[model samples]
Target: FMDNSKNMDIDYKKARTFLDAGLTYPTGLGLGLKIKVNGNYAVNLKFNGKADLNAIMNNPRNAHFAFQFVPSGSLELASTLAVDADVVESGVKVSANLHSSTGTDLTVKVLDGYGVDVKLGLPVKKQEILNFHSDVFSVIREKTGSEVETPVKFNVKREDHGGCFDQLNTLTGLTVCGEVSVPLDGFKVLSPAYGPSKASLRIEKEDESLTAYHFRAFYDNKQPDKLSLEVLLDTPNSKTDRKFLLTAKGSMKPQKQLLIVMESPLTVPTTFEAVVIDTELEQAIAAKLTSDTAAYFIKIGAHISGDINRRKYEPILEYKFPETAALSDKGWIGRKGVKGGRQQQQSAVGISGAIYVEKNPGTAYRQYELQSVTLNTPNIKVTVDGTITIDANLIATDLKASYEKDTLTLNSKIQKLGERKYIARVDILPSKYP
Candidate 1:
């Protein structure tokens, strides 16, 4: 009596029903109840009430009652302080935090019947989780707890069939100020017209090198076609991304070809190879034609002779005839004409001859010594030596010059003669136009 009262024995049973007998053959209302009790167990009676036979069962939209009994007296209601962990199902693994009563975070030890603790953040009161069956997504924490993932997104758009397949290629040579765009995909590249889209890439340089290889692929649903990019690296070891700026503009046409014009500084030497082109480069070179209207003509060769300086006489050189014609005008031929005029005209208007500078024989003479002279006008021949002075109205025919003792001489036909001091003659032909 001092210790304990028998545990209240309790038990209960109940039933309720509603029915209609259209023929009035039978009308029914029923209720059932019962009760039982014992030291450790008990049962109780219940009441009958009207029941709706058409009431919906198992309403998933509304809350449902559930109960669970953990037999282990120590029903660890989760570790008092546990970190929330991820719950992965299908192809998607959601990682978030679960906390303990003490606010200590918890981690998932095993998930989906698999080993691997998926850590979690704080639990959300109302959470919506999206799980993709065809695609896979996973989250893993780093040692330093940082997120390191290259995010991928895909989007697609629609276009007219004609706008989809048109393609083009081109070759461009750029100096310091031009660029080209080479298409990498078919025109109507997006499929499902709205399905996942991706940009594929191929990069190259005019001269292949590691610094030349660069590209990126991305999908923009606002754009109907897959995009491509080629970026040139300035340095072989450039570490920064997007150091160069790029923009592209083009059209799918009633305009036949796809033309992509680019403008950029010649930051580096580069070349682009393409399959087609719709536009001509303004600075492009035109091919040379063999059938040109005008051509360049060049004349080059040589004329042979000996040194005029070595002649025996300081010859008086004359060109052309009649003293009116000049050797400079007719060159070598003019000099011949002057000689011919002397022989034929006999008037001695034209003349050319050579005079030798002579010194006193065996005496090392210091002044003018005449060597010899020949004239076509009168066929005059004269042997000269010493300081002999002669006077004649000399029309010098052809005078050629040479140096002896540094003295100058002239040999020619005589129209008149004078003393050795000087010779004065009329119709004396002079040298060419100097």
Candidate 2:
């Protein structure tokens, strides 16, 4: 009977060693010796060796088995023996076939079976396999304008252990500061059931050096089916290294080897200077500019047009001239705080009119049309009527005025009143009303 138990442990040990040496399974090892007796007879001896599975596994070599035969007693043997190896080799072809769950494609080869020309029984259609890689590769390619096929070289040291983060949420109510770069700025990946929508930026920079990363998706109803990406590169020593903030909503399909699509808003790298809190004087100036009574009133009104964020506006203003009541609620034309009878009469005789603003499509300064009215004494009848034009700087040009049929008529006049403010006036009598 064969001594299977005696060397079983040894074979296992050797196999373990081979496994440690990176050799595959089912490897064999043995030792034998032969002695020549006269010319045609010989004595053979054999012994099985230990199998170190651990060693074979650790090694990078392919796993294999070895066997030896020896004659202990007197035996006669021929110098040459006819051995047909092809048939046996064809039947004993050692190989394996790997199948993937996803549709990813992969190619695998059997080491020993290669030279032997073994046949692989692969499925009619196979899934593809995605090559494992680090995320930095994609980021570096965009940031440095390097091609995707750029030869990148990196080594993992002995001290480095393999690690992974399955799902990360990098942008949870996070704030950005200083220079920062994000490769997947606007990638939107939608779930199979949910509709398409925009994707949010998943990475964020808290301070100058601190950064937080996340893999959470922004939940939305109108997710886009197509994929989108945005790359942010914050250059070193950039002047915009101040209080920065960004709000993005973006999506990701996790199907293996499948194309991932993301959606996001246009990535415009813009910096906003810190809003400097105005001193007491600055606040006072702003208040004075918009406060009541800061503006003057006349029969001729002022035309106003400029860029404002809101679409709705209702300005409440109070006029200061004493005779303004006549031009406004009361029927009188006199300046406020006018002392003496002559001065009061002169203030009452001052010009009064209405203002009109005409905005030029896509132009900076709007056209201002002012209607002024210097009431005739005794009856206090209307008199002047006209229009004026101004540029973006509120510069008045083409100034002309004419009194037609007892009514004032003015031509387009462009004039700069202030940075954005403009002024135009006209006079009109009841007969001129149209």
Candidate 3:
């Protein structure tokens, strides 16, 4: 029954009716009807599925919410909201593709034999800001029911550029605890080739009492060389919280010298100390020369000070030799086929020097000046002063060595053989006196 009047009222005490009808109404349904009938009424209604009751009540505009329903004992609901996520468990993996607005794609994978609790969500519309809570790690641990045992790999790619990283925004509030092992192959493109098989990174950021981030990386390999790096940022207890320290232990030869380049001025104390193989005095003065047997007892210390913009370096270097017993008994430094008796034992050597480097804007090389470099031994004392220039991986030195009543001019050029390998050729000329 249809009514065209503005107001209609129908009253029924007991009625049973089964009706199936489709209705198309205006925004406000411009009519009012009162129903007082009640009893087993089965009515199936279908709308355009774009009608919204809230929109029609607030504003009789074109707003809509399409609605269609069938009366049934069991009903199922479905949604089309897209989500990006990944999970790894018990050798089974599940992941979803990520959508990036900037055309850059990122893939994060947890390597095999490991598990991770990764949660991600994106809004229906793009937003600029992303915030993370301080307890994110804890939340992840709680969800996974255990700590992560392997590293989470990150691969970022850009269609327009070719590099390890491109157009990536900075992420904040990220705290990682426990140990995470990262493969060295992931950073093969970086400079100063990494020789370590793996790098283990550890960070302590869960402690609320500490305001700084304590991070450390241990680079380990089967070779004799080993490295450990530590960094502390925003530490409150120290005078300078931004501290970086690197310590290495390995053989000498190619790895004899440590080079540190700073892009900005450092306000904290930065030091480098290494325990390396001891090349005899001859090998120490000339790189190409080597002893038959080498010992790992030379202690080198260097305090680096310089900034790249200024192009000037002034570092203090000091070398401490091992005890005479170890040097002589162990044959750490000796001439070939020379049998040393008790009276022919060798004496310990001590060296202390400073190096100054200045780069000219017009020149393609930098000059290192050795100032007041003294080498003292029980047999002889020598003073060295020289200017060394390095260009295209070639190191050339013009220096004067004075000992006793003789003054010698030393000219040497060191050539690189391979990775962490070098050979120095020296030509020593002496001036004759009556």
Candidate 4:
């Protein structure tokens, strides 16, 4: 048996030989193996009678995307039914629940090996459950006793590496209540390249308090040089005093640097901190080296600053003015992005400065709020060699904006707010070049 797997090192690289005496040998050489990839779909072929077969997927090459149509008067109700069956040597657990605006309290557990621990539904003040029971390999639950033997059904969707890891983590979370130790043998067996995946999901509810936490870890083999170990934790509930945090920590072997992100629901967070270890500093001084034929000179300096607490970036630019012998007027252009309405958000040109900072900042204030920007100075004659862009909302009244060579078109709109009141909104929507 030979592996036509993607791993180049493990691929059989031997030759089949048939010779004198007992030298006759079976096919030993691995040949005619190629992997065809198109977008997310991949197929591996080894050109042999015995080959791994997989399901085929449909492609919508000529189909246009559209939303699924739902009738106006029709109503769709979905339920969650999880049936876990166990063989004679193994045990399984089945669970089912119906969701409401509040939450779901129904669950079914089936134990075949040790003993049966059946829970139809946890008694809630107002919630009701039918009945639940499990046989050797099936669990039935419904509103009456006649449905005991009738197996429950539900659909499950999954990704290649996404859903299985979630299931494993949930199992681990159920077993780990307090300080629990895990041995190497307890982990599922995996190849060295694609090994080491663990996850845990935990939830606790009591009276008006509820808490949920999910932990996931998996190997990320995308970055060849950097061994990427994805570690993530999300706890959205604030029932505990420890503060709510959604953490996506990078857990890798080198441990050179780990960006453990602790993000709340809002930007401009209340507080933040960082501890630097094995810092590597890099500095460069840019100097102007004038060409022998050149007569004019220019100098520039740049500085970068960031605020972790607010997650804000402020860039400041100061430059040494070059010789202005023939230059008269000089002006600077600035662009500032404010909150926008639906029109602004869906406009051709998007000018969002910090949309990620706030928790879904209102679209009303997310528009262009430009008081003014200087396009020309008193002495300098500004003739931009290339095309220049300026938002009509930010342009000063006196500044004239016209293209030099290209017929720059503007997508402008005028709206009236009230009687004898109007506002001009203009933007250069990007489209195919003329």
Which one wins on TM-score?
Answer: 3
lDDT of each: 0.25, 0.28, 0.36, 0.26
Q: Could you tell me every candidate's TM-score relative to the true structure?
A: 0.12, 0.15, 0.23, 0.16
Best by lDDT: 3
Residues 186-260 of candidate 3 have per-residue lDDT tens digits of 554231112111122222222233332333333334454433222222323433323344444434445554322
lDDT of 4 by residue, 214-299 (tens): 34344444564443343444433434332324332333344333333343333223221121222122111222212222222121
Candidates sorted by lDDT, descending order?
A: 3, 2, 4, 1
Candidate closer to the true structure by TM-score (higher is better), 2 or 3 = 3
Candidate 4: residue 417 Cα off by (Å)? 13
Cα lDDT tens digits for candidate 2, 334-408: 334444221222333434454445564676655545455444334355544444444554444433343444433
Off by over 4 Å in 2: 1-174, 177-335, 338-434
How many clashes show up in model 1?
57
Candidate 1 wrongly placed segments (more than 4 Å): 1-311, 317-333, 337-354, 358-367, 374-434
Q: After superposition on all CA atoms, what RMSD does each candidate show versus the true structure?
A: 40.2, 30.3, 27.5, 30.9
Candidate 3 residue 299 Cα shift, in angstroms, is: 2.2
